[model samples]
Target: MEVVAVGGCWCDFVSISPKLPKKGQTILGSKFLTQHGGKAANVAVTVSHLKGKSAIIGRVGNDFWGENRIKSLNELGVNTNCLQKTSGHHTGIAMVNLSEAGENQIVGIPGANYQVSAQDIDKYKSIIEKAEVVVVTLEIPVPSAIRSLELSQRISILNAAPAPENCDPALFTLPTVFVVNETEASIFTGLPVVSFEDCKKAVKCFLEKGCKSVIITMGEKGAVFGSDATSDPIHVKCPQVACIDSTAAGDAFVGVLAYLMTYRKDIEMEQMVEAACYCASYSVTIQGSQASLPTLTTLQQYFLEKF
Candidate 1:
């Protein structure tokens, strides 16, 4: 049986710089590349690369970037049936600056991403109902994301990235798994997510807000997973790898986690976290967005070498 995954978010065009510029200061960049990105698109491609059936539901402009993004997704074995194109809007874009240390800063132009409405979710209600896991990101309109979450019949995984300034508390309760980085965790909980205890506190706060399970990703420190079903949290250490570009690391983590939830449901949580950690670690060793994601063969080889 083929497990189906559906994602709703933006498709972005990204540019990379060697280092971010200071106030009114200009600097030379090392490289320039274009790839298909956006949290939803990245997750959908990751699912397909991991041998699961995946589809992306979102809007892009009827321009060169939009056309290329759809074609790229199709080539990667992702179903583009729900990727719509708008005539007037431009495709979403992100200007990403990376330091030699693999740190990054991104400025996004929402463009057509913000145009994704609740009506779009309604049009794809059947897809959501049929999918084994539905992925929602904060990059798109909140209403559309909320509607998609509401429509999910099975598991719904929410990757709350670039956390909204004033997110509705009710939105946090809809996902079976709520994933966030330290910064987003801090934003949502209004507490400093600096230590493991801080992450534990943040997890408790999210659980109190109705989240069934909470995952706080602490980058090099590994990740912490807490749930209502278990009293203690599971901490999975990330693999050590030389960092190249940390652009899509989090997206890769979310993608693999969702893929496991959809297809490898019988696996232990520790195993799932290990796989996700490996995938994310591998992603940072490469540069670019979707280009950084590891395919099943690459991931398996990594495990064989590491374990």
Candidate 2:
């Protein structure tokens, strides 16, 4: 496999509301839809959509949601040989609310997703060992995440989203690339990331903790990149666009980065980060999770129109 993603497989319940509701208030939504989601699953599907060979190692419940999750991955051409179904437990569910401005608030109930075990990771050890890029997220059990990190042989990426309550210290030292959003950067570094300089400091914090490279995604401002190879950090600014929903923007970033690193070996990390930002910025302009990810053709057509 070119890329292997070890994390959660979820069916998202999404509502496109005119505005997000306040506490103890209700609001009518403009529309609603359910689609395949979860960080790892979205990454895997995006890789496949970009014509990269991808595999998913995760768990779901023995329920309708689980069935649909597997069917969706299969239909999308993601290798699902390692996707397991637990006998008892619901598949993970995400309640996603999108404002008209494309902002989002999400709460996830990780059901069978939490059932991903270290043994499951061990069972798929061969896949992790052979992949060009191995990606993991925090949606699955901590043990499983740790095991995947331990087994990864080539480039390993840790996409630490839905920020951890108490993060594992080793997580900083293990992955080749550690990615987090600006808010998450503040949380992990205990420093406010309000400006560009603050993001540079956060990158320093992760590198000191032993990460070979770090990326701090600053939402609409774009992302910053740092690594052992340089003393200076690089910031890539993205284009602003009219957005309808932004549920899977982060996942899209991770997936595109992995696809480029796996398929286009000659591309530099800076260019990969730029391509990722470009594609993820495009993702927010559309709706749904995997549905929102821009394909290679869409990306080509978009930039050709813009430039």
Candidate 3:
């Protein structure tokens, strides 16, 4: 069976600042670059780089940013047949401030991303049905994400990012794999994910909510995984690396993990987490969003040399 994955989310134009400005104060930014981003877009590009068949199902503006985003995705070998361009809206934009330590703060404006509708998902029903895995994010309209989950057959991976207030609880029950970072886990479980025990508690909460598996990514500390099929939490430590820009690190983790689960189903959970960590670790060493994703060859060389 061919392993095909689809991503449904937003596409954004990103700007980076050297350091975040304090309230009512301005600071000189060190770098300015436009990149193809948005959590779903980043994941799609990462999957393509990892040698997987990938497609994006989302909306973009009919403006230049939207055109450039589609062009970039095509250049990266991701299928953009399902990506739509809307006339009334502009492509989403994100302003990212990167501290000297590689930590980041971002504010996103959901322009065309908010245009993704359940009808759009219905139009792409065949694409969703044939995909081995469908990746979704909260960047788009919640209804669209719900529709994608409703249409998917096998595995639906939900990357619950930019945690929304008052999110529909039913959406939590649909994904086969639930991926969230520490803050998102905290939001969903109403528990602070400050320790391993807290993460375990959050994992169990998701399982009780009917998720088949859950993974909580804690930067530098690594990630923890729990599944209804397993009895204990699995912790995979991340490899140490110098951080440059952490913009796409989480996207790398989600993308690589999804690729491994779809293409290498026989691999154990530990190996999956390790590969994801490796990919994320490499991403932070570089700059930009999609540009930071390592190709399969790069990953192979990295593991051979570093591991």
Best-fitting candidate, scored by TM-score: 2
lDDT, candidate 1, 137-242, per-residue tens: 8888788888988998888888887699899875788888899999999998899998898999998899889999989988877899999998877788888889
TM-score of each model, paired residue for residue:
0.94, 0.96, 0.93
Judged by whole-model lDDT over C-alpha atoms, candidate 2 comes out at 0.90
TM-score ranking from best candidate downward: 2, 1, 3
TM-score, model 3 to reference? 0.93
CA deviation > 4 Å runs, candidate 3 = 1-18, 301-307
Candidate numbers, best lDDT first, in rank order:
2, 1, 3
Task: Give the local distance difference test score of model 3.
Answer: 0.81
Runs of candidate 2 exceeding 4 Å displacement:
301-307
Write down the lDDT of every candidate, Cα atoms only. Answer: 0.82, 0.90, 0.81
lDDT score, candidate 3, position 12: 39
Can you write out model 3's per-residue Cα lDDT over 82-172, one digit (the tens) per residue? Answer: 8889999988888777776788888888888888888988998887888888888888888888888888888888988778877787568
Q: Which candidate is the best by lDDT?
A: 2
